[model samples]
Target: MQTTSTYKILVVDDDPDIVEMLHYNLTREGYHVAQAGNGKTAIEEAQAFKPDIILLDVMMPVLDGIAACRQLRDISEFRHTHIIFLTARSEEFSEVAAFEAGADDFLTKPIKPRALLSRLAAFKRRDAQQDEISNVIEIAGLRIDRTSFAVYKGDSKITLPKKEFELLSFLAATPNKVFSREELLHNIWGSDVYVIARTVDVHIRKVREKIGEENIRTIKGVGYKFNTD
Candidate 1:
């Protein structure tokens, strides 16, 4: 459903040179590209352009990338838009923070143009494959819609950011089946990602906060399972 020609991307950074370089590379790859010099302008451009992906710089003026990412995550319209934090910082804490703020991926600065192209291509392929799969899963008292990226509890809709929703949906897809943390990290975060295995706990806690803790049961020294029984 997503063609390279129609795929839109927004590159947000404080440096005009970086923005221009990114714009050039992305456009050359057949993507419609937009540029924003700050997080605030990035938000405005995102709202207006409705880009499918956003390459966000971590350090910026007016508003920082982490804050902007959190803000965007709160809005349902940007729920499924892929966000990758592009930063010079390679610290583990920085990566964890980005994920907590709702980034889909993190890329270190000075990224090779070829690497960026490969990553974007992979995402596009995954998205296309996802479209062919069932987007709605209904069980217990919840309805998870992958297409609209929404979750409904009975008649009320409960808003969850991207990662939380994906984790919940993955668990609910196989009710009562326990999944280990390593398995979760591999499946949800992708095996190539460098997130700590313990990061799963943070996301799990957030999911429990939104939904009832009773729904997701944790096994000591094991993993977690969706209790539909």
Candidate 2:
């Protein structure tokens, strides 16, 4: 069970005012907040700040939100970080694209503070409930502990970025379940993001690098499934 102090958040946006506004509002709601002006900073903040959740922007210089989200997805530690993309693009295709990029939700720009707060509260509820389910899973020498938010390979602790850890843990939790990329985005990444199924592949590759090539079974045409047996 994580305490309230553990619920820190990172807000990624190039717009200074947006960052300031969100930082203030979220702080007022009692959430610890950090700010990143670009995708590069976002990743650095993600790694260093270790925020529990992230509010990432869709457009920025150096690195866009989508690209940044993909980068975060590669890291094991931030794998499960709740990410909501705040953007001005609201086209149907764009919304779908966000989901493909591995976002938990999307909020068009000129955000309604009330709606943002409500959605965050909902995510918080789900996060707390999920925290109770337990995360201890072992496949041979590899062990993952969800409750403690840790992973290990033969007693040696291994660190992962946010998205990478979540992907491994999710697949591990359901060994043998043939999960399509779209399914992963919807279930693991959340449907609101607008990326593509390929993002799942990116995450999988990084995870395999951490664990082993044989640890994850990619069913080529179908999708990905954990090789528990």
Candidate that would win on lDDT? 1
lDDT of each: 0.85, 0.79
In the range 129-222, model 2's lDDT, one tens digit per residue, is 6677674898757888877667899868877655667788888888888888888877765543445676788778868887888878999898
Worst 10 residues of 1 by lDDT: 89-98
Candidate 1 per-residue lDDT over residues 1-229, each given as its tens digit:
7899999999999988888888999998899999898899999999999999999999889998999999998787997788988888554446668878888887787867887887787678767866776769998888998776688888898888766887898898999999999988877767555577667888898899988888899988999988887
For each candidate in turn, the TM-score is 0.91, 0.65
Alpha-carbon RMSD to native, per candidate: 2.0, 4.9
What shift in Å separates residue 53 of candidate 2 from its native position after superposition?
Answer: 3.2
Runs in model 1 with CA error above 4 Å? 90-93
In candidate 2, residue 132 scores what lDDT? 75
Candidate 1 Cα RMSD (Å): 2.0
Q: Where is model 2 more than 4 Å wrong at Cα?
A: 1-17, 20-51, 57-115, 192-195
Query: What does the lDDT come to for candidate 1?
Result: 0.85
